[model samples]
Target: MKAWRLGWARGVVELRQSFSNGGDLVSHFLWPVLMLVALFFLRDREFAGTGILLGTLALPSILGMNAAMGMVSMSQQLTADREDGTLLRAKATPYGVQAYLVGKVVSVAGGLIADLVILFVPAMFLVDGLVFTPLSLLSLLGVLLLGLVATLPIGAILGSAFPSARAQGLVQLPVLAMIAISGIFYPLTALPGWVQVVAQFSPIYWLGLGTRSALLPDATVVVEAGESWRSVETVLVLGAWAVVGLLIAPVLLRRMARRESGSSVAVRREKALQRVG
Candidate 1:
């Protein structure tokens, strides 16, 4: 209980810093602006006989994609902390590792919510056909929560696996590929059957599908496979990933924590300085 309280406070502090820090502030706004630009271009485009504007379909999916990206941010933050010895310092304190993990999750989730609002509020005016009821709000909230649970653990695992920020760059390609095929900016129905099947396995797809289910009208189901939202599959697949990741992350995090030391941080800093030089 004490650790959780401390972690929550730490997270709040970091979240505040992200909003105030110049570089972080730019990052917080830049991507959302880019996405809004994309939304603007797509706002009027027809979805090829679907009687739906592509923007209407894409807006919610983009929200979902943004939510799932908490994973990437989590991975990157963890890697940065490890390199900078934040994780090591936390390890020195009682229940500090636990606090650190909780702090990261809170900070990442908070940032995601901010990014969503930055995009969603402006997007509400830019897109149409969205349903906004109390039920839909609750549904969107549920998907966001479940999506975080499913993805954050995987992020922790990835963070633990990589030794440095440069190595962490390797994760970006696959994530970008996943976003492309997972139908963030496009409809999955346009893709081949095999591609659709493959996309279903990803949490990104489920996040998008879930968000669309909440925000889109019933008629939009035509664009989805089986002409349905597959709510059960969304919960099950995301839950499965959550379960597996929960099982594996602690062990890996603990192992990684064990391996960190003053020497390792110095070595990484030295190499980083050499590269800069």
Candidate 2:
């Protein structure tokens, strides 16, 4: 109970810091603004036979992609904390690692929600054919929550496994590729069968699909697999990943935290300085 309170407080402090920091504020707005601009241009363009504007389709897909990017941010933040001795400080305190992990999850998830609002509010005015019934809102919230649960733990594990920020940057390349293949900007049905098969296995694709299901009209599902939203499949696949990630993340995080010490941090700093020089 005490740890939970401390973690929640820590998360609130970090979230406030993100708002107050100029660089962080810009980052929070930049992607949403750029995406809105893209929607502006594509608002009138048709999406093949789906009879929906490209902007309408792209809007929800972009939301899903943004949700998935939370994983990358989590990984990067963890790496940064390690380099700066934040993780070491956590290790020194009682129940600190647990509190730190909880704090990170809360802050990152909260920040993501803020970003979504920044994008979604303006987007509702910009796009056409968007359905916002009570059911749709419920579905959107469900997918967002499930997507976060599925991805963030794996992200923590990845962060724990990687030794440095540079290595973490490398992780982004594959993620970018996954986004491209996942059909965030277009219909997955239009992609080659092999690409489609590979995409089906990716959380990004399911996230996008789930978002599309929530926002797009039932007819729009014509462009999707089986000409349906596959809500059961979305829940199953994301739920499976969530279960696996939850199982593995603690083991990996504990292992990583156990390895942290002042000497290791100093050694990393020395190496980083050498690289900069």
Error of 2 at 42 (Å): 1.6
lDDT per prediction? 0.92, 0.92
Model 1 regions lying over 4 Å from their true place? none
How much does each candidate deviate from the true structure in C-alpha RMSD? 0.9, 0.9
Candidate 1, residues 1-277, lDDT tens digits: the string is 9889989999999999999989999999999999999999999998887679999999999999998888889999999999889999999999899899888989999999999999999999999899999999999999989999999999999988888898877988888889999988888989888988889889999999999999999999988878999999888988999999999999999899999899999999898788889
Predicted structure 2, TM vs. truth: 0.98
Task: Give the clashing residue pairs of candidate 1, or none.
Answer: none
lDDT of 2 by residue, 66-141 (tens): 9999999999999989998999999899889989999999999999999999999999999999899999999999
Candidate 2 clash pair list: none
